[model samples]
Target: MVDILILLPIISIMIGLYFITLGLWELREGVNRHQYIKYMFTGLFLLFILTPLVWMMVNVLL
Candidate 1:
């Protein structure tokens, strides 16, 4: 959990950046505003789930 707590924000920011990029692309493609926000939030939620798994994998590998 300590690993998770510490890593979560970094992972979230990286993921958030992805969503922002995707949102921008979609916006250029004329995607709806609602859908844009949805994808961004989904990415954030995924980050929350992925961070702990990533930390565990790194610890195991190294």
Candidate 2:
């Protein structure tokens, strides 16, 4: 539980980065790169969501 609370947002950030990479890949040669940029932002937004969860966990757990 403690580990998860600590790691979820970190993991989310990494996942977000992965999406960004995908977006960049699309930008380099994809016909529909803008769609991927949208996906990247979605991931980034989701990562933001994870931050509060981690914060709440810290408040509750310790």
Candidate 3:
């Protein structure tokens, strides 16, 4: 349980980075504007919101 908790943030960070990269690629191509926006939003949310939320949860649990 503790190991998983500790790993969550790292996973989120990687996923967030992947999404942001996709978003940037989409932006560069100037195609599928809605998808690009959604991707960017998801990436920011994961990096800024979810990562800290999980970090706080881990701190509380430990």
Candidate 4:
């Protein structure tokens, strides 16, 4: 459980970056910027919001 807590953020960051990159690539295409914004927001939410939230939960629970 603790191990998962430690790894969660790292994994989320990697996946989040991947999603953000995909979003950015689509943004460069300039066809459906609004659609890709969802990807970017998802990434940001996972990377920033979820990561710290998990860490805080882990710390409090532990």
Cα TM-score per model: 0.48, 0.66, 0.96, 0.83
- Give me the candidate number with maximum lDDT: 3
The residue ranges of model 2 lying beyond 4 angstroms of the native Cα positions read 47-53
**How high a TM-score does candidate 4 get?**
0.83
Please, what is the whole-model Cα lDDT of each candidate in the order they appear? 0.71, 0.75, 0.96, 0.88
Clashing pairs in 3: none
Candidate 1, 15-55: lDDT as tens digits: 86788678777777885988777877777665666666766
As a TM-score, model 2 comes out at: 0.66
> 1-62 in candidate 2: lDDT tens per residue?
77876777677778877777777777777789678779778777766776667677777877
- TM-score pick, better of 2 and 4: 4
Q: Which wins on lDDT, candidate 2 or candidate 4?
A: 4
C-alpha displacement of 22 in model 4, angstroms? 0.7
Ranking according to lDDT, highest score first: 3, 4, 2, 1
Give the range where candidate 2 is weakest over 10 consecutive residues by summed lDDT: 46-55
Q: For residues 1-62, could you state the per-residue lDDT of candidate 3 as single tens digits?
A: 88999999999999999999999999999979999999999999999999999999999999
Colliding pairs, model 1 = none
TM value for model 3:
0.96
Give one digit per residue, the lDDT tens place, for model 4 in 1-62.
78987888789889999989989998999899886999899999989999898788878877
**lDDT of model 1, residue 18:** 88
